[model samples]
Target: MAPVPKTMSGILIEEVGGPEVLQWKTDLPVPELKDGEILVKNEFIGINYIDTYLRTGLYKAPLPLITGREAAGYVVASSSPDFKEGDRVTYLADHSYAEFTAVPDVSAVIVPDDFSTEQAAAALLQGLTALTLIREAAGIKQQLGISQGPFVLVHAAAGGTGLLLVQILAVNGAKVIGTASTPEKLALTKENGAAWVINSKEEDVTARVKEITSGNGVDVIFDGVGKATFDANFDIIARKGTVISFGNASGAVGPVDLFKLTPKNAKLVRPTLFNYITTKEERRAFTEELFELISSGKVKLRIHDVYPLKDVARAHQDLEGRKTTGKLLLKV
Candidate 1:
């Protein structure tokens, strides 16, 4: 193997404030690969909304932290037998806003020849989250007493995970109601199998859902837009329905009175990503399922914009402003 570099450039969160806080520096040292760890030369890094939370102090992280959740690349060095030099892989790891990163061997998956490096990076974090959201969190099939299809409502339906959720639901025969703010996004949702799309800005979510479902309400709601959509969930959810509160893109959801759900006969669930894919076995299963879906053409990925690593601040700016669509990536 070639000699490892002494320094690398990355976007650092010196002190959280806004996109302006992401300081790009060339003096950051390349991390050392320890036992059971692999060093990756990143080719593609994904920008998720959660990264914005950390940057804006909505979610706290240690000072001077590198701010990327996932990336794909070739293994440059390894200390574990499970991976070798030059193996193409992708992982959900901390400190990925750089040219190279070190992650525990257990955290990465080998990229199959059929899968490109960009595809792997784009799919890991969001793809698995989508899989669990549909098959586990919502449990629509079990709740509706059917395997083929169930009624579902998804907020921010044009998002990376939202788009995948809609695709997965459509493939499994589920009828979905997606909410987006604009006509373009709503059109994308419709193309992806959303039977009805709600322009949350222009229309009342509850009223539209009632008109579409004919007053019975939806079987489940996968909500990531916290405060803006939380109240509407209770208004539209069916009796015994499940609300998966997975994210807070609009704003953090405030205090809730549990009694509110009692009237609707519904329940709220917040499924954490770490809890779902904790073990290597679980991660492998998710990767296998996700990869199979993509390889077989059952799923597709949309690359919104590929920003250069040096332009991370603008990437953060655009992502935070909600000016971009689908998956936003940083070319490492």
Candidate 2:
């Protein structure tokens, strides 16, 4: 093990704005561990759309915030019995874009021996999100009631969570349709097990979806694009189809008419990872399933880029510019 630094470098966002607000500082104090906390020397940090939201003021947090939500590393010190020095772990928690981070032992998941730190960090958050959506939110069953075949639509198909969602839905025997903006992204989505890939920019999404399903439409649409894709999603779902709108990458989805549900007997649900894994039991189940999937090679991490900790602002810029095809990371 390398000698722990007394002061660590981190990306600090003093105000919510554009990428310019993310300032890298090298002299920040190494966060001290509280009781039941473990100090991890972060090897890789996950960059996500939610991080972009926080940077752009779409998702508000305290000003002058240390702005990272996921990472993987080895425990350097521990005040918790569950973890000890040198145990490799990954977590979806705040303030992860640093050389060292203190996280509650309960919040950290032990990475399998064969998994690299970078792979663990890249996969954990998105994998867990996919698990919650497929197993809990959508209530995917052995046989979906009233639906002849399970068909699902996933928006932002090239993204971290979206790619995992594609694989998970496919493994559950659902015909998965994924949407992406470019040919490269579409190829990536297809490689991840999507049965169909729609170019949201070129195709008339609803018409294509109708044509694909022979006009019956799909059983479920997992939309994270919010305003830009919601209407098309509504148009293409089969009667009583469930629309799971989980994010707002385009912009915040403001309001909708309750009567919209009455016409087709359709339903809409807004689910967050926080809600699905709220309890320890639920969190444990979710992680265990995800770990099994990854270990068995049923799912793989789509890590598109890894930047040094000092270049976090550039990572955020790439994320905001929509240049990334999959999960981005910060090497700490």
Candidate 3:
């Protein structure tokens, strides 16, 4: 392996506003490894809505921050025995919008030889989000009362995480209802595993959902559209159902009235992926399952575009505009 560099190139956010604030710098200091840390020379970085959240100040972080949550690369230096030079890896960590990142040993997972770095980068964060949502946030598999698999509603069903949710839910025998705005997105949602698709742009989502469910409402809703779709969840959720609100693509949900869930005996969950995999054992188990799904062709990935590091502003613009579908990546 080549010697680790003293400085690296990456996007730095000095002020929170818009994509224009993602300033690219060639002389940013390379992160130094602390105990149990691995220094990764990033090859590909995953672009997530959370990155935009941080960039726009919707999610707060200190100024002059290097903002990104995940990246796939090869190790260049390590302070832990778990990783060695040239070991390919993908990890969840801060400051991933860079050429190199200092990742905690517990957060980094070694990439199997057969899994390309691109696949690892594209699948790690969003893939895990889907898996954890079904298995942890909603605990679909443990709901023994729902014998025939619960009816699931996945908003943005053609997007990166939504597609995974549809596939996994269908594979587990759940009847899935996916919502997307465009015809192309709706068709893609159907192709992925949705039993029904609703065009949120043209149709009344609540009424369509009611019609599809024969007026019983859905048993579970995976709503990432936040404020725009939050209230409607209560209107469509069945008795004893779960509503998992995991993202804020439109805007953050306002204060909730716990009373809203009372009428249906419903449950609301606001979960983050990190909380679901807090230990090495938990991380390994979830990651192994996700990888198996990918290898078995049950969970196929769709890369919307791989932007050059210098074009990150355009990448963010496209994402915020909802102009692209599937995962966006940055080649470092």
Model 1 residue 199 distance off true place after TM-score fit, in angstroms: 1.3
Decide which is better by TM-score, 2 or 3: 3
- The candidate maximizing TM-score is 3
lDDT of 2 by residue, 72-165 (tens): 9999999999998999999878988788899988789899888888889988777888888888778885445323448899999898789899
Q: How well does model 3 score by local distance difference test?
A: 0.92
The alpha-carbon root-mean-square deviation between model 1 and the true structure, to one decimal in Å, is: 1.9
How many steric clashes does model 2 contain?
0
Write down the lDDT of every candidate, Cα atoms only.
Answer: 0.87, 0.86, 0.92
**Best-first order by lDDT:** 3, 1, 2
**Which parts of model 3 have CA positions greater than 4 angstroms off?**
142-147
Q: Which stretches of candidate 2 lie over 4 Å from their true place?
A: 1-3, 142-149
What is the per-residue lDDT of model 3 for residues 99-174, given as tens digits with 9 covering 90 to 100?
Answer: 9999999999989777899999999999999999999987877333323888889999988899889988888778
lDDT of 1 by residue, 1-332 (tens): 78789999888888989788888889899999899999999999999988989888899888989988899999999999999999999999998999999999988989999888988888889888889888778764323422346678989999888999988888777888999989999999888878889998899889989898889888889998898889878888998888889999889999988987997789899897768889999888878988998899888988888999989989888876767768989998
Name the TM-score of candidate 3. 0.97
